[model samples]
Target: MYTTRNSSSSCTQGGFNLGVMHIGAPACGMNAAVRSFVRNCIYRGDTVYGIHDGIDGLVEGNIQEMTWAEVTGWVGQGGAFLGTKRTLPEKHLDQVAARLREYKLHSLMIVGGFEAYHALLQMYEARGKYPEFCIPMVVIPSTISNNVPGSDFSLGCDTALNEITEICDRIRQSAQGTKRRVFVVETMGGYCGYLATLAGLAGGADAAYIFEEQFGIQELQLDVYHMAAKMAEGVQRGLVLRNEKANENYTTDFIFRVYSEEGKGIFSCRKNVLGHMQQGGSPSVFDRNMGTKMAAKAVTWLTDQMLAHRREDGSVFCDEASTAVLLGLQRRSYVFQPVIELKCQTDWDRRIPLNQWWLKLRPLLRILAKHEAAYHEEGITVKEVEEALD
Candidate 1:
């Protein structure tokens, strides 16, 4: 059953009835985005509807009118205030359109990740079948995995990275206190390794195993040998960051065994799986501010569409096909692009290519990790190297 957070009186005095929902995995800063959108809508004299449990609520006709006063102090809150679900809207297209009409929603603000965008694409394709589904929508990428395409950074990524880095820092401290110790920390990133890679880079990990880089027994052996060699050089402690899905053949247990057992007592290994803990935490200032910024942009775009549909007597003339856009930060700049562009061919394993900048940034992370001091000695700062890489 779908549920509403805070119910209010019907919003009959409406300029534009905007609906908002959070789909996919729950992440920090989701509430912030919701608050920002609601505030923007209210400021513009538009009515806002909070769809509970994401698209499922819309399908079930579960929604509530939201006002700015109710969502105060939600910017620092974690998780989705209106709730969320993994279900896609495409499966319930007819019901979704009916609910949209029932609530008189002119535009929808989807706060979620890759699956949300895919749902948007499906809705686009199903437009001809369900003419009432022509409501304009905007997607705000908010995932801890940071795997959403067309964006350099997604909301909740910084907060999640901070959590992972803090945990890795404590593990590193423990490794330092113990002789011949190596800490194998597993981080959450699904098939993408953005979280693992960034955590390793930020936490000073000796090595990181991510899905972007192929990993097998040969590669694991080399990493083990490298850590052993570093230990022999009196490094005392070594940290290895491993993405949860880095390799199908290699598990965290297997890696620990190879280091502790196969290394012949050279190092005492421990594994710390930073699982869902990475997804829970108060959002960082960066995430709060970024969420507000992105949400504001989405509201602005939505308002523009509403204005375009406005009639002479203040009634909004619903259009034939609504514009669907994905708000993202591409190359450190805010940009909105059609959600259809995010769709691409996937392989047998369901692996799709990520942003090109992320692909380039992956190798640079390794270079910066290994040769920061060497480059510094040559009057080449890490910032310069990063610029060159970019």
Candidate 2:
């Protein structure tokens, strides 16, 4: 086992208290993160607290110190064991600061979606007013949506993708038994289409509709005609995956109706709106390892920041420019990007990253699905593939 405490820091190190909380929706790898964080802190002779139900729980003093044994066997668990809520800490920002002070935490670790990023940023901005908000607060992107900025990959996304792929397999099997059937499946990604695009590739979907790539009625009809062409060519099963919030006008049901009407005697149509089941299941192995490594790195990094900024008076020096950050994976390297620095890369209204890596892979998805669009002659090289996954 790797030593939890870093012995090479330039600054004198001592015991510290760190708190962890889960914010936003429940995710598959969250429990693994919590376990790794608690174990890392305990091994370093530091106190770790589990803040229940996010900022609301923090305001209510629902936090309790975590034990090493409590987190043992949490690696494979799904969803958040610490509980979570999407409630942003805007209104309760003061209460959040007060709780941090009361807990005497040296740093804070947040696990969960874009909302967690927003909440941490709010506290970071208010650090000038409240010293309690000045600690090294870090967010580990754990949402299945994979929408958080500063990160190429979020924690729960792989598991969610696997779930969607398995469900699509089952749906396709049902379609295969038919003479000709076209299925329109809706996936969850808020306004982002990362899941739909990738799932389309994995499930052999003929077309994928995403918010990043706008599609009107004409485009939908064009896709229907293409599906008909494929059916005419003896293709029996057709799959079209669409992001849940891809467009206000083009809904899953509407697409199903359009496909049904256009296909007529050519094929049958079915629609499946995958509900919360996408968020439920044992975390995939990739997610478990990702969460564990991210948590271990975050704990170590936060400690270094805390010790590096420790003032003579024992209070941590609050540096607004570098205090709250997100631990995002950049091409397999652990990047601790300041949350404030992510504003330009973030779509605040949509709660998605402005530069989506998966969007670059859409052309590849289309080409593989035989969509009538010519892509760059380079045809997505291996280097580009690795870079895109970054």
Q: By TM-score, who's the top model here?
A: 2
Off by over 4 Å in 1: 1-14, 311-322, 345-353, 368-389
Q: Give the TM-score of candidate 1.
A: 0.88
State every prediction's TM-score relative to the real structure: 0.88, 0.93
Which window of 10 residues has the lowest lDDT sum in candidate 2? Answer: 1-10
lDDT of 2 by residue, 1-390 (tens): 012244456224557888999999998999999999999888877889999998888899999989999988899989888989988888987788788888788899999998999988888888888888878889999999999999889988999999999999999897656689999999999999999999999999999999988888978877898899889999999999999999998899999999999999999999999988998689999999999998988877887888888889787766657668888887657788888889888888888888976787776676677764423333656665555455
Candidate 2 has what TM-score? Answer: 0.93
- Scanning candidate 1 in windows of ten residues, the lowest lDDT window is 1-10
Instruction: Provide the lDDT at 354 for model 1.
Output: 47
Segments in model 2 whose C-alpha atoms lie over 4 Å from true places: 1-7, 10-14, 373-390
Cα RMSD to the true fold for all candidates = 6.3, 3.5
Q: Write the per-residue lDDT of candidate 1 for residues 250-301, one digit (tens) a residue.
A: 8878887887876676778888888899986799999999999888878777
Error of 1 at 86 (Å): 0.4
Clashing pairs in 2: none
